[model samples]
Target: MKNIILLVFFVFHISLFGRNLINPLNKSKDKNFSNIGLYIDGGTFGIGYSTFFNIEKYLSSSKSEKIHLFFRGSYGDVRFLGSGSGGGSFFKNTQTIGASITMITGRGNHHFDSSTGLFYRDESILPLLDLGYRYQKLNGGIILKGKIGILGLGFGMGFSF
Candidate 1:
């Protein structure tokens, strides 16, 4: 079940953003860019494991903001960790796949997952929100980022070109 969802998301990304959406937007500045950065992250809470990462390129839209999109996939192994609701404890893992949109304005960022839900015991689709600040590297790409929400707080490093 997890594998199927991830595969579907990979196909969706290639068809929607990789082949069609971003190319047309980059036709003009095609010569000024090279490659996109890659990222990988994994961490664990008391009884839960979470990971988020993506690889993407930025399509120059205007001078002030950049239109950047990335295919991001996340999987979490969650357990009640301790006594909780109905039962003494519970455990389950969730898989999520979706795309993220970031603005190069340096102030903030946002992302939306078209299909995100849990697997195993409880199942539901819950949209996640990411609020963070990005810093552009002097050479190219992004250097640092920070975001916080129901997912918790995180500090990460990324490359953008």
Candidate 2:
């Protein structure tokens, strides 16, 4: 998982600079905007919302891609599967808070994002990794994300604004 995450990051980093090398004159201007999204995860059967802020411009002007810092919060009632008749079934209300750094690649309305971060759950903080793709119109768009964290492996879809 760590290797895969590193590879994804490497690929996006290369893509970000590769575009600049290809055609410097054709490079687009920086887009700095905040996005808010709601998502549901299969790992914990949780629903969450997140806010992303594009902070690359403030940090540097040389880069052509956007880098975002995001905060997410989620809530869910997770059922313990396979408890059997003797053990019965149990459910827990779970909550999580996370922060991540995301790099955005591609152009126009369609973009790909690679993110890595950390989340707090069940009294412990754990690393979180995700690879996501989004399609945005003027203000908002749809987002699809696959992630691995303390909650395990999960996929989610939501609207981003």
Candidate 3:
């Protein structure tokens, strides 16, 4: 997983400068205009998966080239999957739903995900940070990309059109 994440992130950065990808929200602003993709985030503290559907919109006008705010949420996770009648078994599964904001640095993208919801009759809070490059295709269709952070890394091919 680590290797795959690295490879994808490398490719995204290379594509940024090489293709002059449109960042939409520059670094100066306190928010990112719009972004829609699959969120794969986790941390060393927990052994679970996070799937998110995000939508970010710009709040101000900035020319520094950065992403500030991006609306985010994690659908749920498959932590528990087992069943028995004779001798019931035990498993752990969870899900999270919350809000998040981001701030971009100089070279890479920086963002965070915080979600809290009930999963399997249990309450939980899941927070994560992601740092990587986001690429926007020139054709204005779907954007294939990846993200690497302190928690877990994600490599996904998505669309922005």
Candidate 4:
């Protein structure tokens, strides 16, 4: 009688498992799709575009997913960059070209942003620092950012993915 009962229990478990009615792991069907995007930024250095890659997954041991890094370069007109422009400017209309590193932290689509780096124009090098807010999509979509720092105010919008 005990043997018959064991066999019946085994068959029931197999039937439920075969139909995916008893999922033990409960893993999602979608993950690690894509993580990259590009956008245009306008500010003290004029208008320019920047591309960013998501590096949080590689650096974090947990799966929380809340950190990002970016590189920036400026082109066009270096408008208000000059001696009295918070150390990042050097005369108006100066062709500005430089790079910066930005770090972002927070949760969901909202985040706190910070950036620092150096750029050169007209044979002079200047530094930059900014702090502001960022709106980033979870999967991939539109992105917006704003900041105020040593280099003045900056704002930009673009897409990600």
Candidate 5:
């Protein structure tokens, strides 16, 4: 099930953002960026990574606020170390999958961001929300965001491609 979901996610990303597919809107500098970042907590409650794209910009509308739709997932290893009968350490892994929609408003490299989403993690469903700040370039470059909210405090670093 995990593999299948991951596969579907990758396929979805390719179909939507592949450079080979010619879209007239992609020519515009502001609309051409996609982001992938390593996140810690960030309302996810677990350490993982996320990828997102500018949906509104991709659709060719230059709205007051740009909306980004993020697809996030992770297979994380939780290790228990002890000095008991079992003697050493054991590894328990967990799977997480979620999607979020973020609204961002700003002119260029600085922006105010807010996000809300839901996730299935460790056999439980969780709600995520956050308000934050983002630093990223218009064409494509690095991405940095810090947020806090219902899920907790979180930070991310990645490149906008």
Candidate 6:
């Protein structure tokens, strides 16, 4: 009786958990899902907001990994002071507009992505690079991201849908 019960339980366990172990690449229908979120970063004293878009699922092939594209716009103020007897204070407004492409790799909701791109600031164009990590819940939960780049380093939290 004990041997029969043990065999039955083993079969039942496999039948219950086997489906969850299937490879994601084997699923044709779920291979192309898109996700969007918002993020914020601060280099200077002012805060910056940007939108994040993931196009990897749509563009991925058997040999390619996930890739994402992002666009950002930010505004901040800078103050400068002169030296010596003729010292004076000056304040200026700063703005930046940029775009980037990132390659993402990891498992489940956690990912590490590295990106390189360009930004238009101070009437000229500048190069920007960032290596970041993010945790995004697929079934609707909290989203978090942190990055370090040429501009500076910052962290952001938001919701994923």
Worst 10 residues of 4 by lDDT: 53-62
155 in model 6: Cα distance from truth in Å? 0.8
Error in Å for residue 54 of model 5:
14
lDDT of candidate 5 over 1-161, digit per residue (tens)? 87347646655664566543333323345555544343333334444333222221222214433543344443332222321124333332334455555656676889887767765554566786679998876456777888876545667666655
In candidate 3, where is summed lDDT lowest over 10 consecutive residues?
113-122
For each candidate in turn, the TM-score is: 0.55, 0.47, 0.45, 0.56, 0.58, 0.54
Give the Cα-based TM-score of candidate 5 against the true structure.
0.58
By descending TM-score, how would the candidates be arranged?
5, 4, 1, 6, 2, 3
Position 41, candidate 3: lDDT: 38
Residue-level lDDT of model 6, residues 64-110, one tens digit each, is 33443332322222122321123232322234455455555655688
| TM-score, structure 6 vs. true | 0.54
Model 6 lDDT at residue 128: 68
Q: Rank the candidate models, highest lDDT first.
A: 4, 5, 6, 1, 2, 3
Task: List runs of model 3 lying over 4 Å from the truth.
Answer: 1-48, 65-68, 78-93, 104-122, 137-140
lDDT of each: 0.45, 0.44, 0.39, 0.52, 0.50, 0.46
Task: List model 3 lDDT by residue over 50-92, tens digit each.
Answer: 4544333222223644323333433434342342122444443
lDDT of 2 at 85: 29
Indicate the worst ten consecutive residues by lDDT in candidate 6.
Answer: 52-61
**Per-model root-mean-square deviation over C-alphas:** 6.0, 11.6, 11.8, 20.1, 6.9, 18.8
* Candidate achieving the largest TM-score: 5
**Candidate 6 lDDT for residue 95:** 40
Record all residue pairs in model 1 with backbone atoms less than 3 Å apart, i.e. clashing: 141-160, 142-160
RMSD of 5: 6.9
Candidate 4 colliding pairs: 81-89, 81-90, 82-89, 82-90, 82-91
